[model samples]
Target chain A: MIPVSVTRDDVAHVARLARLAMSEQELDQMHGYFEAILEHFAKLAAVDTEGVEPTSHPLARANVTREDCVTEPMDRTKLLANAPLADGECFLVPQIMEDE
Target chain B: MNDMADDIGLLNRPAHELAALIRSGEISAVAVTEASLARIEALNPTVKAFLTVTPDLALEAAKATDDALARGEELGPLAGVPIAIKDNLCVDGVLCTCASKILDGYRAVYDATVVERVKAVGMPIVGKTNLDEFAMGSSTENSAFFVTHNPWDLSKVPGGSSGGSAAAVAARMAPLALGSDTGGSIRQPASFCGITGLKTTYGRVSRYGLVGYGSSLDQVGALAADCVDAALLTAVIAGQDPRDTTSADVPVPDYVGELTGDVTGLRVGIVRELMGEGIDPEVRESVLTVARALEGMGASTGEASIPHIDYALPVYYLIGPAEASSNLARFDGMRYGHRTKERAADHIEMYSRTRAEGFGPEVKRRIMTGTYALSAGYYDAYYLKAQKVRTLLRLDVEAALGQFDVLLSPTTPLTAFGIGELVNDPIAMYMADICTFAANLAGVPGLSVPCGFTKAGLPIGAQFTGRAFEEGTILRVGDAYQRATSHHTSLPGLLGAGG
Candidate 1:
């Protein structure tokens, strides 16, 4: 597969997918950054990786479970301390749902 | 003081020796803490090594150790030895920004498991060090705070994302500092700053409280003035943590005691691919010098190849950013950290604006690249293929290590470059890590030692990659090498105080 020549639209689409707001200048700058990075990835495209396993993690372990028991949770006050907008014990964020 | 450790005052002394001085009552822990704090106070403005200095915490721990010693109680091994913590690790109520604006005004609510362990041992806490924003770049220039200057030359960068920690130790502001490695973050800076740095095997240390970067590749380790100091710190922080299931149940070795300084009868492999082409001629010669010295110590040397290691840079860029995109997804203007104040119409708008405002250019670039690679129609072409190639790299490394006790290479292609030299050409900056990234990709332990310096007076480093969970072996080579050579003894003539 040939490396896709990422356009400003592609950069804009990716940034939006990443939930990052960017000015036109930033998007233009990122277009160059992505072009260089993708060009580097072209070698990986040529390499034959058939029958190879993907390593999601270095260690080969999973399902780390413990006996269900009551335990103290992180202090609500402390957890809320860095919240940009906090309401008593909860984090206040922009409304997610609209009234029907 | 011992002969090798002579000339330099209390601050230049290694942490283990300082602990011995305190234990013998020849000096009080408070004096040691004061010396370290004084050094930081005098030089940190110029070096920009530390983002926060905890004098109160340092003195409090010192006093406690002094009280214990006065009562005729046995002193802890690292008692009153001041250490700097990388800001990415939580330190409970202390600032824990990964030198990113995203985490500005944020303080940790609990100690990272590593910090808790350090405090439990009663070592004085000096401060939090700076790094690349979210550990994203090759230089501390990405830090929202300030760039950490290499002690050797003020104009050069201390390589990141552990630049601040490496700078602190090189300037002798702290004898020990903890840092995390994902890619060449720890070793590359250690080489540039001329300190002994050890990047442990992925499962050798806990990551419970470290800020997530490339989760699979990240390992907490140390930067120090010498091999003994490196061994002392790595030993204290390493062990299986139930909280981090990925941490291995392997028994932590007695790193200091096991440093018998004997590389005799062991085979050392000079990794051909890591030394040729892109590597500087002087840096390659410095690595060859280490191989020669080891040969003189009765160890035999030979050429070795990992075959697939040449592809590590592209593979690392792919995998690290992909994982980073997922690991860092939590920074979405919600639970904690910086949130935008601009009036917003909806949730996505708030998150987008907040990240755009908070993240640095490097961070934004990475998040975007990762999103693109993992998005529809491109996953197989990029992310998945990179992962599969990672397996090839790992197997090749395993095969090589199976043939030799350790593999040697230059830590970076060259010594420290001027501050803005490669910062503009991102790919060029990534090339600096050519010799070191494969260790992270392999999840193996690697140690960088001061090999030699260039005619320009900048330091060069030789790295030894050990088999998984075998930090003691590479450390043994580093310890033996330091005992024979005085390169590790040299420090920057910056502070206008030491030596």
Candidate 2:
């Protein structure tokens, strides 16, 4: 069950930590949303996974073998044809110039 | 013969028959492509399913297929079929935004391995479809740009983050679509939208061009109106690729040839943990119906417990978000994606403003949760603990699989809910993956097929999961169940329904 009292401040804290700039209205709306979410997550607290060791990956299988042979390269012209901003044989970028 | 014309008119015709028509010169590839496009145009707007529709490209590809056939060139299986790709898949020169604002303008320079294979076999891509932002939520409402509604009912959600893929196939917008399942993205959506979806073993199919979410759990799968079509698409795309490091070295089995629907002497386990508590009664009945159907088909069915199954959702929340945070780190509004312009600011300021403006709310939530879980003080307590627990969860399935060929469960606890119902409650949204997440955690194969519909006409799906690399078992079970019933054959009453 999610908590009913989750505040806009809690959502703001989370947004700041996430490096997001949310408006006050969005924060107010998100508080009620987060509260419901926390309640739903609270159900997991009742679940007992205490002694069970947590697994990161499901596969016990490993050691996929592969040949080290080099393959032909994809045509560079074709590869870079779709770049939105490009220079001659290179991708262009905004310059970070100093104004001393 | 005009019989070819009538045959091509049927939207749900089996793949093999459609292939025969194309090969025998009775139906041109262009005809099938046009039929699919016309169907999409007729229904897609109401459904809000497709993000992009590539009519020109599809027609051009179809013309190329017709030219090839005219020259006596051999077309591979599923030749000339039009299929849609989930926006998350990289299609060179096409937008592959994963349905997010951050990647609004980003296009891939290369095709994903699966996309390349399908194209090589002469399948034309219809377009990219909608999904949750970075394939995160259980409903497509989380999509940054649009909400894809269930074709069966407009007010209800089509499950996510592959909702558009499932809905597209359900709406007959495409004969088939490829989807990636991370904690039930493919199967849940399939169940909700009433189609056949398969989540192959983690490495069974190459993940070369799929934008990463949970790398270990995500496997590219297929959505089709029927099992045979699903098998047909799976055969073409399932194979080893040097580009994706995790792609299996195993030989690609003749999946099409092996669709015999014969499962005599095979052991099927009904996971007891999944049936009780919170699951809708209708979903449980549907699972039991399929189990009984399989049992009658000479497969022995019994109840088995994967005790740690309930912990899957919790473990997934930790692991999926952690991986997502890291994977999405590349989208700093630097290379390509929606970037906010900052005046009188340094590089860091530009980066911060761009990211803040680009990512949606759910994406931000996951990134924060992931960052906290992997942060200095909490890494040992949360992230490491979750990884260890994942191994234990996998062992639970291993223990059960020791006695059974496959496990059975309701693909989702309920059918499609109202769109905003779970979105406001993120935990509830996460809970939607409870039944399907275990297979992702264990990196095994899972398939969801429409078993029955609820009293209100919503679809209920039954999932069959198998041991790693034993996709044969899962497919066989699904084939057997589908053969025994007309559930998978039934289509949404498209009379006034949205696609």
How high is each candidate's interface RMSD, in Å? 1.5, 4.3
In candidate 1, what are the lDDT values of residues B131-177, reduced to their tens digit? 99988877888899888999999999999889999999999989899
Task: Report, to 2 decimal places, the DockQ of model 2.
Answer: 0.33
Model 1: which residue pairs collide? none
TM-score of 1: 0.97
- What's every prediction's RMSD, in angstroms? 2.4, 3.7
Candidate 2 chain B: worst-modelled 10 consecutive residues by lDDT = B1-10
lDDT of 1 at B181: 91
Query: How far does residue B183 in candidate 1 sit from its true spot (Å)?
Result: 0.4
lDDT for predicted candidate 2 compared with the true structure: 0.81
Compared with the true structure, all predictions reach lDDT values of 0.89, 0.81
Worst 10 residues of 1 chain B by lDDT: B1-10
The candidate scoring highest on DockQ is 1
Model 2 stretches astray by more than 4 angstroms:
A1-19, A22-54, A60-98, B1-8, B495-499
